[model samples]
Target: MFISFEGIDGSGKSTQARLLAEMLRLQGHDVVLTREPGGSPGAEEIRRLVLEGDPDRWSAETEILLFTAARRDHMERTVLPALAAGKIVITDRFADSTRMYQGLSRGDLRGIVDQLHGLMIGREPDLTFVIDMDPAKGLARAKGRNGHEERFEDFGEGLQSRMREGFLALAREFSGRCRVVDGDRAPEVVAEEIAEIARKSLAWTQKA
Candidate 1:
């Protein structure tokens, strides 16, 4: 089964992704934990370009292409192979990030985003956890992090707020595969909730 965790910056999506992978590993499942736009070697190179730079480094349309290219590389080199081997794949983020981030930064571009995804990367995770939290609180948490990947987090609280709404909308739009998890609690609490959701989702996917 494949699972993804997503949310605005500092919503603990990465941490929960890692924790869920670890928990599944402890349960004796072969679990592969990865993230985009840097899962494969080639994708990692693209990741550096997209994540670490001036915010306006690429035109919004150009940025979309870069992200789609990275995702294609990641799926071909990492995601598809692992899934073929019957392993659990958990990722920190996925195509939904593009839908939200690009839509926010470049104006309404959902049509183009969906078209590019449908044309190139044509699969969705069996389950997705959107760690819902307040934008201001999420920004405060992200503030402590230091890295070149600060581009998205640097969008400030205003953008983060909009992205939060976008994610919630997406969760509803993809209700069959997405779950919104409250992210205001302790990490342990959040991890437990996600693990349980993954457990149920995994069972359902396997049965199907």
Candidate 2:
């Protein structure tokens, strides 16, 4: 099963992803827990350049391309191989993130983004969990944990709002495969809900 967790920063998507992977592992299922833009070595390097460098140094289109480049490396090296072995792959973020951050929020080179999506992960996640939350609150939670924010992390209110809208748009477009969970709830509750959703989705996918 290929599953992904998507949401704005500090929305607890990563935490839930880890928990879900652990739960599946406990069930005697092989699970690979990873994150995008840095899953593989080459992708990690690209991630550093994209996230830590001067924000003004790269244009929006450049930013989009960099993300897709990292994604290509990640999919070829990590994601596909694991899935081919019939293991559950849980990713913290994926191409949908690029569509939200660069395409909708930054309005960059979206044509290339779409092209890469088609060429790369033509088969989307068997199930996608979008942890929905208010952007301001999410940012605050993120800052609380990390102490400081990075370039993309500090998008401020305007960009954050747009990103939220972008996520919703993507969810609607892929309704059959996407599920939204309330991220404002307690962590344990969120995790339980996600686990149930994953179990049900896996069952349905297998039967189909």
The best candidate by lDDT is 1
Q: Please give each candidate's TM-score.
A: 0.97, 0.94
lDDT of 2: 0.85
- Give the per-residue lDDT digits (tens) of candidate 2, residues 118-178: 9765757889999999999988887677632267776676777778888888899999889
What TM-score should be assigned to candidate 1? 0.97
Candidate 1 residue-wise lDDT, 72-96, digit = tens: 9999999999999999889989999
Report the C-alpha displacement of residue 94, candidate 2, in angstroms: 0.3
As for candidate 1, its clashing pairs are none
The TM-score measured for candidate 2 stands at 0.94
RMSD of each: 1.0, 1.6
Error of 2 at 92 (Å): 0.5
